[model samples]
Target: MKTELVQCFVWGVPVYRQRFSLVASRPATERFYRLIRSAMAHAEQLRDPFTGDLECDETTFGGARKGKRGWGAAGKVIVFGIVKRNGVVKAQPIPAHDRASIMQVIQARSREGSLYYTDDWQAYATLKLRGDHVVIRKEKGRPVGRDHINGIEGFWSYAKNWLYPYRGVPRKHFHLYLGEICYRFNHRDRDIEPMLISLLKRLTVDDVDLN
Candidate 1:
């Protein structure tokens, strides 16, 4: 059961209760998801603040509804993300894509004077004062020059793709799901099985024996 759960997580498969019901109870399957979420949250918390060349972007999450799409689309959760070139990426749900909300994430998760690469979003205009901000003007379907948000944009794609199987994530539990994606992205090059085993051993209740 444990091995199957680990495989599901490593492969980005949704561990539905019905899928694991033969070997594990419904509560146990839910517990496994919680454990995965906990491990991911811990890993994300331990990540170093992003420095140097960085890409920042905002994405909206939620199903299609009656209204606008992208940017300030109503009823969708706003998520702000930052990725250091060839390094770690982090994302969190925000209340809005306004200047204050965006800058708050930048100040907390990034280092001072780190070069920020982003689209020509007005919210990012103030970032120029704190660091070297490169605005990538969209040309046709791509950004001009070497300036591109592909790194962070890739993360959004990776996250959404991984999440699509779940159909829809509850708004309250969205952050935990996001954390899992961030963990997967950050550890993309590492052998995830051993890392996951270590985290599980440290976090799971099974490790503690009752007298």
Candidate 2:
């Protein structure tokens, strides 16, 4: 992958174009993309910094729909993301924002002793009893303690402004889109070529799709 990408760079083709060329073989490509998807699926794990005493929260994805407010949401996907103070972040799409949905994500990603920070949402109120849930009022002012949810918020902001260039993605295929985003987020500091290489190493030809 590195060699091919370098070849593309020297030849003056876009990386995506190079990606297309690399996966020209159908059987190999299908397996390749599958590996990429798999890498994305387990991308998020609570960071060490946040795990010691963390601020956790959930938020919805997608932009405002033209005709209506919540109607626009129905078409958009919902995701829950958390950032530990140490700067590790993890995110996943959730089916809904109900208690069961939120709890499942929290338990899976968060450690038992971690400090959870969140807004005054009813779902997070239980954090106090279960662990150390600190509630804040987003409108009241800024939250206190290590209760800042800025990390996850920043992720959403990037997703909306930077990554949504394709616009109006179908809900059915949201996971693929998410996999790509998670890959990028997990490797934020790495260059595009290395980043692609890292992703490609774990994935097979099945993971990426140009068509």
lDDT of 2 by residue, 95-123 (tens): 88777887787877777777777777787
lDDT, model 2, position 25: 56
Over 127-173, each residue of candidate 1 has an lDDT whose tens digit, in order, gives 98889999989879798887798999989999998889898976777
Per-residue error for 154 in candidate 1, Å, reads 1.2
Kindly report which residue pairs in candidate 1 clash with one another: none
Best-performing candidate as measured by TM-score: 1
List per-prediction Cα lDDT, in the order shown.
0.82, 0.60
Could you tell me which 10 consecutive residues in candidate 1 have the lowest summed lDDT? 202-211
